[model samples]
Target: MSKLEHAELVDGVREELITYLQNGTVNKQAVARTLDITELGIDEIDRLKRIHFCLSSDVVDFIETLQGRLRRIKTANQRDREITRGEVRGGIDWQATTRVRYTESAGDRTRFACKTPYTEYDIGENLVLKKLLWLVHSTVQEDISDINYDWRREAWPTERIAMFDRIYARNVHLNRIRDGEDIRVTRRMLNTARTARQSLYTDAYRLYDRYRRLLAGKYEDEDVSQLLSNTLVIPERLPRLFELFCIFQLLRCLSSRGLRLQPIESGAKQLAILESDQYTVDIYHDQNGGLSFHVPLSELEGIEADYIDRYQNVQRRHGELVDAFLGNDTQPSLFSGRPDLVLEVYESRAREVLTAVVLGEIKYSDNQQTFTRGLEELLKYIEFAQYEEYLSDLDIDIQGLIISDGVETNRDSPLDGEVTHISASDLISVGYPESWIPTQIR
Candidate 1:
């Protein structure tokens, strides 16, 4: 298959796998049917199932750890508040008589209108516990929803069912707090709830342990043993994880270069600002960098009318790179293409001047074909930026780079001259140099 075709196949498989893992009902049969329809061989399907189990197991482990930590969190001292009601009484609030009403017929009767207050223990730890419980509940529910396997049959071990039930009950009890169920009225009841947290963790641990033991035991078929082994491999999540990993790595590099990195607080975009004493860099992801341009209609007199028309048509159709040339508007065109990452450099001191803009693409796959396709795409973006006169008019040089797992590139490749292909690790280790910022643009 061609590289593009293979990438599409990988993406399709990933979506199916994600859907299967998130399904609340563990419907393995459904997933098997889907895989069969895709024409994946039995072996391939089995491998994918094993990977699903491994990732799901990791999630279970995470919840187990979180619950354990919740159990260990030191309980806070309980505070008591005086409250008064009919029949139940505590210390009197002499200053507040609104709750007291005297009846003429039942004058001076203690039962009729007694000013009293009772101390109710308020355990602050319950709030923490409730929040932690909610986290556990939500995490489990999400994981369960992803599961495409049905566990109604005896095929699923009894222990798993029991463990899930215990956790679900805990979630329900905590959820009831919003519905007037008090979790901290009495000391004994509060203590019991605290202990239940530990018990839940223990039950979950044992359930996972049982699975591990079962997998460890020798099976009649070697293939079955291999397939059921505890080892888990998930390539589907790698690309996104790699992207995040790069973001943080770049953050660290920029920090090392005496720049303070702050995430932009705008809801419309996910971007970060790297500020130094004299300069700033705006990191944009999957957005147009919030730029627009205005050009004088007369500028089209020099350029071909058809070419200008085509450019304007393309700009309107894509809403990406806007018209950067020939206009009083200082902003560049909204870039038509959304790269994985974009860095816009500026001089922060005195006058805020845009120095350069860098576009980047990330490819996590080690496959040569995938790397080539990504490189081509990166080159195309660079070409658009370079050939577009409007982009040049912005007075900022445009550069592009591809971050990928190590891949060999041809020396004569067009990308070799304009775009840099750097391993993700190396890029993180060595900070991106200022030289990469085109001096000519400044």
Candidate 2:
């Protein structure tokens, strides 16, 4: 093909890419499938195949000049020679920690500072979040909205378009169709891609969390409360996200129990999260130690928004009221050093002398059937809980209960013989029975 045809083909490819990305088909394989292409080896970036490709002389020159400056900085600093402001002009900060000073071969120095919360990890967490968000945003705008398979048939060069057609047939399995039937794929394929994308997205988040732990090691001597706030972003906007995860376990548990929750706190006026009576429930807790629950009437609705909004609101309000409710000496759970949860239960009068003090740890996963590691952590906590009280002074029995979200209670499952999984959903279905929750037992 002539140069003009090649450029046009590339341009058309770009248009198709931007379109499919908008409709959530952001993967290169997915894009190739829509275009019916074979051997869509991703090179450079996904858009390289689409847009007109030209390396401007000016751009090339700029990159070469920057690289030369970087080399000079290395050479100048090699012989224990002083890097004066004049020698290191226009330079990018290699360390990326404090003030970023870039020095070029010319004697010019420009200094810029980024005030980041991170200190030890060198803003790795921030970089991860920024990169992931940018990737997601670009994918949504470019690939998701512009998906139009019909356009693949019209106004395109034979070879490139045929490549996309072939890809679509192979990956999407269009061969099963009858002679006259059109090639087609389902939303399931798109969903599978989405799931894979989400899995990768979580890796970014987990790596960020790892960066946080690395930073924690550096601030070992600092107060735990201060260290936690400094590392983790606060005014936490999503408490119910974690709660929702907990509820999923709770729901699975309820399913086994063969029972469902009824509408209890489903009213709009009573709960701010209940903006509507959809398939979601909204439960509320106040920082002032007040608690209210919302019950949804049905299923097949958005539970995430309703639960997250209400829980986050409570967490926020709690911060303001916590000082008054819990004495000044009381550690706030919002702080890093504070306990994850505090349950105040009315003690049973019949048990005057407590028997044993135990620490409980909870684990939820497929791999660890038994919470042995949790038991170890609880042992440490148990020591702290009982350290001061001698056996004679101890007047009540306390036992630690480690809850595992992934423990299988099903007698049929391999875990049934050993690991015991508690159902959070079943507990909720039972109206969050006080006895069921050890922390809340009175």
- Once fitted onto the true fold, the runs of candidate 1 whose alpha carbons sit more than 4 angstroms away are 1-135, 138-235, 266-270, 291-336, 349-352, 386-389, 410-417, 428-442
The ten-residue window of minimal lDDT in model 1 covers 19-28
Q: What are the models' TM-scores?
A: 0.46, 0.21
**What are the lDDT scores of the predictions, listed in order?**
0.46, 0.30
Q: Can you give the lDDT of residue 436 in candidate 2? A: 28
Residue lDDT tens for model 2, 259-304: 3333222222211111112122222211111111112222213566
Which candidate number would show the highest lDDT if scored against the true structure?
Answer: 1
Backbone clash total, candidate 1: 28
Q: Give the TM-score of candidate 1.
A: 0.46
Given candidate 2, what's the lDDT at residue 358? 24
lDDT of 1 by residue, 228-341 (tens): 332222223445445544544565566666777553342424345667777777766554463322333444445667877776565454433333343333222423355677
Alpha-carbon runs more than 4 Å astray in model 2: 1-240, 243-339, 346-360, 386-393, 409-421, 431-442
